[model samples]
Target chain A: AQSVAQPEDQVNVAEGNPLTVKCTYSVSGNPYLFWYVQYPNRGLQFLLKYITGDNLVKGSYGFEAEFNKSQTSFHLKKPSALVSDSALYFCAVTSGAGSYQLTFGKGTKLSVIP
Target chain B: DTAVSQTPKYLVTQMGNDKSIKCEQNLGHDTMYWYKQDSKKFLKIMFSYNNKELIINETVPNRFSPKSPDKAHLNLHINSLELGDSAVYFCASSQTTGGSQPQHFGDGTRLSIL
Candidate 1:
């Protein structure tokens, strides 16, 4: 089964400063990685995904993630942080073959302070 | 327009009661999924349906059953609800069977068992 890990439980950053949420995955084959954000009392919204091709994948809300095959990491990154970006973030992965069900991380609570 | 929607945004019921959460997708995706988010904010896949057929059924309790009448809808029916069943239930849909495409999610149904 594919699995994802978010090492940090919370990440605090200042507004306008670049922020990052770390994510790693363990899968048998080429992994399909994804990043999602969840606001308070809401469902998780899809942010971006990495299937193949470019290592740097840009997504919604001016967020991007880099897929590192050697490091086995898919970290979410934003050049500038905003208070609105403060929310729970999750990393997910699915194996290349077999079940397409995504395995998600525990989630990281991001707090962007002004 | 909302791509995915779920009925009863909030559900409050006593233990031993039964409840059902309805989900529908307007994106015309062939695959639909049910996910459970615990208090700790851990998201896990509960079930998945492809073309109205049960495709992925996780280790969810037998009391929880999913029904898919068509490709556009997948509803979750929980029997004899327990306190442990209290959590946020989310419905999502994707265009492809594989994990290449990012899944779109609904707001979610927050079930509170008392």
Candidate 2:
């Protein structure tokens, strides 16, 4: 079975400061990781994904994630945070060999202070 | 235009009542999915259909059934709705069932049990 863990329930960062949301995964085969953001009363919007090739993957809204194969972790990062970036972030993972089912973490609430 | 859309954005009903949430995707994708987001912001996949065929079904109760009339539409029907069924349901679509293709999502339908 594949699973994802987001250790932090909430993360706070000041505006214009860098922010990171940690994510770790456990999967049998290769991991296909993804990050999504959800605003209030809205569905999750795809941020980025890490499949193969480069470890650093860039995504929408100036967000990026690094896939560390040695550590089995894929953490989302942003160079500079904005107040509008405050929302719920989710990390999901799926195995390359299994059915198309994504296992998601509980979610991390990001609060960007101005 | 909206790529993915769901009807009945907000649903409020008493226990034991039956309700249905409809979803449609205009992205010309072959795969569609239904997900439930609980109060704690935990997301879990309920069902997925590829080319109008059932592909993935989680451990959801029999009371919840999903039907795909065509490639673009996937509707969810719940019988004997309970308090535990109250959550935000999201519809999503992807180009295919496998690989690193990112899935697009609809706004979501918030269900409330009275």
Candidate 3:
């Protein structure tokens, strides 16, 4: 079975500081990973996806994620945190062997304090 | 333009009542899906339709029925609303059912059962 794990329930960072939201996964085969962000009372917006490419993937809103196959991790990152970036982040994974539905993590709430 | 849209952003009804949430995607995708987010914010795939055919059906109860009139539209109908059904329902679409196609999600509908 494919699964995703988000270790942090919440991540706090100061404005203009670098931020990271941790994510890990367990899958039997090659994994297609994705990152999504959700604001309060809103649906999720796709941030980026890693579908067999360079380790570093850039996404919307100045966000990026590093895909580490050895570490089994795909952590979301931002060079400089913005208050507008504060939202719930979800890490999802799907197996390359015909698993079309995404296995999402519980999500990590990111708070950028001004 | 909204790539994916869902109707009734907020719905409040009594137990035993029936309700439906409409969803449409303008991205010309071939696959549509329904997901439920529980109080703990755990997102789970409920059903999926590809080219108006049932593709993925999770372990959801039969009370939750998803209808896809066409490739661009998918709607969810609940037979009998229950308190446990009070949560956010999201409609999503993808270019195809499998492979690395990314799914686009709607704003979601908050359903409350009194």
Candidate 4:
């Protein structure tokens, strides 16, 4: 079974400081990983996805993720954090050719303090 | 225009009552899905429809039935509402020609069971 694990339950970062959210996955074959952000009382918003691309994938709102194949990890990163960036982040993975659904991790709540 | 939308953004109902949540996508995507998010922000795929055909159905209870009238619309109808059913339901869609793509999600419906 394909599964995703977000190690941290919450991450606290000061405004203008760099932030990172950890994510790891276990899948049978090649994995298509994605990052999504959810605000309060809102559904998830797509950030970026790593299907078959470069190791560093850039996404919305000055966000990027590094896909470390050896580590089986795709950690979301931002050079500078803003107070409004505080939200729930989810990392999802799916088998490339198996299922169309994504297996999401227990979300990591980001708190950006100003 | 909204890419994807779900009706009844907030639903408060009593136990044993029946309710339905309607979803539609104007992105012209060929695949649509339903996801449930618990309070802890753990997301799980409940059902999916591709071209108006049932492509994936998770281990959800039979009381939760998803109906796809067309490729652009998918609706979920619950037979008997339970207290456990109180959660946020999201509608998502993606364009799947050969490989799956990043899904676009709606603003989710918050269902409260009394």
Winning candidate number (lDDT): 2
- The alpha-carbon deviation from the true structure for residue B48 of candidate 3, after best TM-score superposition, in angstroms, is 0.6
Predicted candidate 4 versus true structure: per-residue lDDT over A3-106, tens digit per residue: 99999999999999999999999998899999999999888999999988699999999999999999999999999999999999999999896568789999
| Candidate 3: residue A7 lDDT (0-100) | 99
Candidate number achieving the greatest TM-score relative to the actual structure: 2
Q: What's the residue-level lDDT of B1 in candidate 2?
A: 95
Better of 1 and 3 by DockQ: 1
lDDT by residue for model 3 over B1-114, one digit each (tens)?
999999999999999999999999999999899999999899999999999999889998899988988899999999888899999999999888785888899999999999
**In terms of DockQ, which candidate is stronger, 1 or 2?**
1
Q: Could you tell me which 10 consecutive residues in candidate 1 chain B have the lowest summed lDDT? A: B96-105
TM-score on 0 to 1 scale for chain A of candidate 1: 0.97
**B1-114 in candidate 4: lDDT tens per residue?**
999999999999999999999999999999999999988878999998999999889999999999999999999999899999999999999997333488999999999999
Q: Give each model's clash number.
A: 0, 0, 0, 0
- Compute the lDDT of residue B44 as modeled in candidate 1: 83
lDDT of 2 by residue, A56-77 (tens): 9999999999999999999999
**Chain A alone, model 3, TM-score?**
0.97
Candidate 2 residue pairs in clash (backbone atoms < 3 Å): none
- Find the 10 residues in a row with the least total lDDT in model 2 chain B: B94-103
Q: Every model's DockQ, to 2 decimals?
A: 0.73, 0.71, 0.70, 0.65
Best by DockQ: 1
